[model samples]
Target: MTTLTGTERKNITPGLSVSIVLKKDQRSGKLTDGVVKDILTKAPNHTHGIKVRLQTGEIGRVKVIKTGIV
Candidate 1:
């Protein structure tokens, strides 16, 4: 399966499945998976990743955009 990076804001949308790294988890590179609830990044893209809020209310910078499923 092919995976997409989450550095661009346009590549992400609400209700999409994604993996994100919370602020506290950045050092550990831990990924939190969830459906996107909101797009928090204002720019077209971010060098790190686009910030988002998951359905579960967790906010983080997107790391992976899981495709082929919603």
Candidate 2:
């Protein structure tokens, strides 16, 4: 097992809203905010961020955890 460092995935729980960077939008550094519909990451940790599916059916890695109103 290896521990990931530098830009590692953030802690995300189901039902929590978060901003993610999809594969298609990673180049533009864009962020899509939505409620966490499902957590695709099963391992304890990851390097490239946690993978999850948003309520809107978009899949991406969690970049920021959206807490307050946007």
Best by lDDT: 1
Query: Could you tell me how far off, in angstroms, the CA of residue 29 lies in candidate 1 after the best superposition?
Result: 0.4
Q: Which candidate leads in TM-score?
A: 1
Tens-place lDDT per residue, model 2, 1-70, is: 2222213434577888677889899899798878888888877666677888999999998877755543
**Model 1 over residues 1-70: C-alpha lDDT tens digits?**
4579999998998999999999999999999999999999999999999999999999999999999853
List the candidate 2 regions with Cα displacement exceeding 4 Å. Answer: 1-10, 68-70
Per-candidate TM-score against the hidden true structure: 0.94, 0.76
Cα deviation of 65, candidate 2, in Å: 0.8
Worst 10 residues of 2 by lDDT: 1-10
Error of 2 at 55 (Å): 0.7
